[model samples]
Target chain A: MTAILLISSALFCAGVYGLLSQRHAVGVLIAIELMINAANLLLVGFGWRTGGAFGQSFALFTMAIAVAEVVVGLALILLMYRSRGDVQVDQATELAQ
Target chain B: MNPLISAALVALGLPAALALLLAVVPKLRRTGKPAALLSILGSLLALSAAGWLAATWLHDPKQVLDLTTSWLPQSGKSMSQVGVHLDGISVSMLLVVAIVASCVQLFSLGYLSDEPAPALGRYYAYQSLFLFSMNLLVLAPDLMQLFLGWELVGATSYLLIGFWFTRPAAGKAALKAFVVTKFADSGLILALITLVAWTGSFSWNATLPAGGAEWLALFLFIAVMGKSAQFPLHIWLPDAMQGPTPVSALLHAATMVAAGVYLIVRADPIFAAAPHVRLFMTDLGAITALFAALIAMVQTDIKKVLAYSTCSQLGYMISGLGAGSLMGGYFHLTTHAFFKALLFLAAGAVIHAVHSNELSDMGGLWRKLKFTTVAFVIGSLSLAGLPGLSGFYSKDLILEAVHESGNPLALGLLMATAGLTAFYMTRTVVKAFFGKPSHAAEHAHGPGPSMTIPLLILLVPAIGLGWLAGPMSKLYGRSYAFHLDTIGMVTIALGLGGIALGWLIYGMGLLQALPRAFAPIARIANGSTVDDLWALSYSKLGMGLARAIAWFDRYIIDGLMNFLGWLFMWSGQRVRTLQTGNVQDYLYAVFGAAALIALWGGWR
Candidate 1:
């Protein structure tokens, strides 16, 4: 369980860095999902180590929320993509002051 | 007799039910507006009943009515709850709302009679909705309910102001009205959130720590500042005159503008505890009163002039409440509604006859529209703070309260402003009504009884409502040994003098003999700079707020949605490439992904 937690932390760090540094909006979104999943895996690992069922339920609930988020996020992304063709975040300068 | 339920039902429920009736009935389609008018009549009876009940409660000071129901009981300490507590403050506001709502409906009947039947129905719906929100605002027991009601009133005003949606200018005015007040509403919501976090309850009865009270007061003041159109944020009211004149009578000139003062008065205990906030209210009130009055002096559009006067008058009430004379503020609010609505509806009648809002395009309306001219003059006299009029009582009470405020300078300047108010209001009367017929009024005539009757009814209070002051002072001002003194008589003399001077120069052609100090000042007082400012304010800085809001919606509000779409397309393109319109390729890709997942799981 501790080993799983240690591995997931590295994945989470990589995911966050990718999320911020990427210029393409799609890459950024994928990286965010990766980061969230990594955190979820760490929660499951902690649940195993602590022998706490509460932690496991929390992790499961978090996963459900993430699924809802993805569905909403994808719908919105489709709207944006149709409005403006390029997926690059910098090209989405329609909102910029 | 459950007076609490009955009053609350009348105050809040009747308008909503009436609006619903208008919506559902088909055979009543032609009767839509009369139904709307009757709905407000229902409000009048309900309001009279509520006022009687409230008066009874006031008579028996020990009687307090509480209406409570569980809101969020299961959420423990974090759960939200609300209590509906009816007292003198609610009674006062409820009475004001009932009176103004009824008049607006009566005024709308004539205003809308010429319109297509369907639009009139919609107009009544808007009116009912407005009354609903305002009534709720008065009876709101806690910060949460209060804000909900507050927001609803603000929204109704915007809708009604911009009710002529086909006109670009009307739509623009409505949006400007909403965004500007919303700027203040945000501050208000923030203050409520802060109070909830710190005190664990969003209610007036729940006292906050001293520091919290001060912070909350500052936030509430910012909101009242915007809502009541005090300094800087006031740019919306003059432009708001673009709506139909009945709407202008209802929202811009009367009850909607008073909601801010009602809010501060409703939250008096919170304000009273914060000395700084109370002081802020006083200063804002004084400055706005003087400033808006100055602008009103220059407005050539008759409605625009009245709009600025409404702003100035509202400023007076705000300051009165701020001066620790909550009762004085409330009194001024009541009287201001009577006269302001009278003025606006009278103005509406004049505009209906002449087919214009521009005073420059109207003159000698009195020869034609006699009752309108009379009603307008009475309204003007009240507005000018004449001695036997409602304005004098309320204005003097504010002054006396300011005297009690321990701020001699504020009181003095406010008194001087009384003189200024008289001068400008008299100017409006001279330019609009008491002149040779301009082109518009050349063919003008009096409006119908439906219009003239409401104007006359308002005069009941406008002419002598101030006489109630001595007893009211006793009822409301126990802390101060109040006396109705002759200090206002001096102001009255000056007001009459201003009217006479205006009558001579503008009305009777005595501009030829005026002293230079009053001359160049009076000349510039009626100059183009004032119109230019009114023009700028009326145009609402050319749609800056709407552009900003739309920009926010496109960017911050919609950004996340766009990002996800991109992610889906990118992944879908990669995944779909493998499908290749071939069943073999799909199976192979799926097997490959499963094998890779199993390998990764084994390694981990």
Candidate 2:
């Protein structure tokens, strides 16, 4: 359980760094999915240690939500790439227009 | 409502309705005939209403009719009222205004016939508006209503005086008349506010606070000095002759100018309490009378001569009122209205024929215009105060009033002014009517019946209105005999002597110009020096003050506003750079702020 927590914490930190440093729209989406999965992993580890199914069930629901979020996120990135002819989020800077 | 009140309402309302109709209906406003016919019909209706009101008042002279409704209600009572106040004074003034206004409108039809249709329509609209304003003034129940009517008439006078607004001189004269009167009107405004503040009502009969009457009277008299065209302020009036001649007759000579004296009569209770102000009024009136008459003596324009004579005549009315004789002042106002309107309309006829206001361009007009000549002669005779004329009766009463006031100085000045009035009028008659025809007069056309009829109608009152003085006296609850006293006899002799002098110089050509000894007096009376002084004062003092105010506004006031605007704009530009439109940058800021908040909470 301790090892699982360590792994989840490392994964969350890596996701945060990727979100801040990424210039591509798909890269930001993948980083967001990684942070959600890291939280789900911590939930399952806690459930097994406490011998309660409540944490595991919550992790199952979080995983499903993460899957749905990734699908929507990838579709938006695909549309952005089609419009701009590139996946770089930094180039699409004119939010006001 | 009383029948007299209804009559007064009609007298006031018809012209207002006509003016409104002319204003609101574009189709009606563009046609001369409809506007003229409507204006004449409205004025005649107003005249009949006024006549009926006067006759009813004459039937029962003692009854004072006051019918008012709450205009501005406050705390279960009215602060001001709108209604008719028909006493002898107002009724008489109403009749005078009605008569002069109707005659002037009739005469304007012919006088302005040559104008384009739209311009003619505008002229009649203004005339109807003037009539309404004058009648409203005559019928006002309180100082508030009076001031409203007063300003309305002033505005209408401005519009009418600059009726031919295409002419630069007409526009300037109108502006001069408006600004000068408006400056004096500040006194009236102060008096009204003070009266309302102290007494809590705008009624003329409101009991004033301690020592309020004198100041109020003095303030009202200051306004009178401007409206009545008294000395110094008399400058605007002669210039106002730049308007059409009928405008001069109605506004300057008869109704609007007499409003000052009428105000004194209406607010007699206040004026009666202020003896020092009355004395000031007497001395000022006397000086204005002599001064304006002296100026009238040298004027080359027929209308200018009449304009100055109006100032002189107004002085007599003011002096009579100042001497505590309402009968003298008001009766003179009645008679003067008729003869002066007659004179101005007759002058209009001559000007109409010759197509010029200059006396140099008019001569031998009597041969071409017989009816107009006769009318002009009768008007001039009445104005000269010849025995058995309307001017004789009214002028005698004023002199008698001044004599009784024990102001020998005022009496002397008025008597001399009477002589000068005759002299200038006779000089005008001889120069314009009797001398050899000028080049313009040789081919002069005669006025149509539209012009001739009003002159003929006004001639009756100009000749015979004096005989009604005894009956007119009853309206004021006084007795006036028709007998000539010693003072009356002396005034008549001086008048005849002035006529003789005028005839000898101009008629007989005994003198080519005024004697060299009188050059300085002539130069001063010619008005150049006084006019120049006024111009200099206005350009130097008035314009200088305006410039300083403008500078303060542009720099000090505007600078503060500009600084506030610049601060907002500069801060907005600095704040706007945060919006780099990068998604990762916004995400970094949100995470950083949340982390800092969580760290602070944990530490606490």
Candidate 3:
């Protein structure tokens, strides 16, 4: 279970790198979702490892948080499209300070 | 809350409440006079608190009245401590702000009363805010409070500077003061953060850790330059006079401009830790004093001359600090406060009497406004360091402190600057009131009862504060009588020389013949180039650097945004083309994405 958690953390970091490197809008979005799922996968792995129902309940909360995240995330994409008619996050790099 | 805490909080609240009540109630906002009266009263109360602080100082120099309670205590971290420190420094500044703000408020009551604009309410409101922020600044227990006071002071300046919002010059002046000071404030904030991080507290105790003291000292001094109209950053002060006359007194003459020096004085123990920084402070003080006095020589505006006088006076105080006479520095500061505020208020009266700032536009107006002439003459005498006036004792203390500075050049420059201060001030006085009537003198009228009373009241301090210098020294337990023989003689010579030269040039019209000999150099010196160069440097950092940041933000930063916006317009049309009623293509792309992900994951 610890092995799974470690692998998922690596996967999330890789996902972030991929998201940053990607030029295409869909690829970046896919990479971000991958990062979130990687966290969820680790939570489930911890649930199996701990075996007290505590980690499992926490994983359930993470899943709920992940759902809200996706909803807001998709809404942002729609809003960006409405305003700028483009979903390329790299092109919308106004926060690059 | 303890007594000091309650008083501190109330002092901060009074002007703020006045600001709000006058604005919303409308009826209370009647003329500048009523608003000014309320503000003056509030400041008087605050100053009375300062006097009480001084009375406490007579017993114990470090007699702090701390009041604190639990605030945002984490599991391990302790509760936040909050209380005003009525130390020597805080008491000095508190009293200065109170006295100067009260006088300016009274002057404004009569000065701006006749202006038909509705902006008088807002001006009075901002003046109250200025007092509120200044009070917080000196009494602030921690860095956070100091920062709040700092920003509020700047904001009040922005509002007050642009009081005549319709005028482009006023708008520019306000913006220049805010943006320029913020630039210096950024450096100061960084230094403060660095100091706090290293020391874990912002109290003015003598326990700051090692290696960071020098950095903190330098940064703090830099902040002083920006705020106090010190060298290379003081250019915004004169332009700031474009606001109403009372605003001129509030900002340029009295409390707001001196906040920087007040900060330096408050942080004395911390700055003392860095010997080299203290030396650097000495040179900064010298350069600013000499340079400001030089520029003041060529000024034609009554307000601008006083503006430069503020710069020169602040230079003396800052130099006194560097000279290692804390008591002397503060003595000069207090005396300078009374006279400078009186001068600005008197200038305001004159501007009201004859609606112009140009000295050339004013002449023989002393006869028209009898009380103003008296007030202005006393104020000017103090400024030129006349004996028996407030300035003589304090300024002599500064020069003697400089003499004890063990630096001859510094002493020389200070004396030369003294002569220049006298010369230029007499020019301003002579040009405005002493000479034959200029056309503007026809409109000159004495200010009403409200104004004359404040001016007269200020005169009591203007002449009296000089005698208090020795007592003030005793008040803080570090008594030292200055060997002021040279300084005293020099003061008289400067005063007499200034009066003589003013009489010779304008009164005798002697310069009319020498125009061909002196015209080019005089024009160049006073013209925007030298002033701008002085201004650019005095503006705190090179305006070029600010222009660079603005240029990058304006052209590069905004340019990128615009580029993206343009790209969106063009590419958006193309993106719409991709969606040309083709559901099959969209499905194909999604399936392709899923297939790619599946293949990638399967390989991993």
Per-candidate alpha-carbon RMSD to the true structure: 18.7, 5.5, 17.2
Model 2 spans with C-alpha error above 4 angstroms: A1-97, B512-515, B560-604
Best by lDDT: 2
lDDT by residue (B1-604, candidate 3, tens digit) is 5676576667667777877877787777766566666767877787676667666665566556655443435456642344465556676677778777877777676777666645666667777888888887877776556767887898998899898898999999998888778878986788767765666556556376685677888888887888888877887888899888777787766777777777777777778787788777777787778777777877788888888778888888888888887876788888888888888888888888788888888988878987798889889888888878888888888888888878677777777778778777777887788878788788777789878887887898899887766656865567666445866787678777866776677667786654355456556544355447755575668667888899999999999999999999989887767663433344447656876898899999
Q: Mark the 10 consecutive residues where model 2 chain B has the least summed lDDT.
A: B511-520
- I-RMSD for candidate 3: 13.0
Task: List ranges where model 3 is wrong by over 4 Å.
Answer: A1-97, B1-5, B23-37, B51-62, B69-81, B116-118, B510-527, B530-604
Per-residue lDDT tens digits for candidate 1, residues B1-604, read 4766676766777787776777677445456667666676777876786678667755754455767565655446534555455766676567767776777788778877788777777778778878888877777777777888788988988888887889999998888788888988888998888887787777866778757788888898888877888876787788788889988887777788888888887787788888887887788788777777766666778998898788788878878888898778878987888898899999999899889988887887789888888999989989888877889878888887787888766676677677777777777787788777898889987787778777877889787767765545543535433356765666677677767776776777767555445545545544345446755664676566777778888986787689789899999888666545432344346555766898899999
**lDDT against the true structure, each candidate:** 0.76, 0.90, 0.76
TM-score of chain B of each: 0.84, 0.92, 0.85
Query: In candidate 1, what are the lDDT values of residues A57-88, reduced to their tens digit?
Result: 98899989888988887777788788887566
How far residue B585's Cα lies from its native spot in candidate 2, in Å, is 23
Task: Give the per-residue Cα lDDT of candidate 1 at B26.
Answer: 48
As a TM-score, model 1 comes out at: 0.73
The candidate that wins on TM-score is 2
My TM-score estimates for the predictions, one after another, are: 0.73, 0.81, 0.74
Q: How many angstroms is residue B542 displaced in model 3 relative to the true structure, after the best TM-score fit?
A: 11
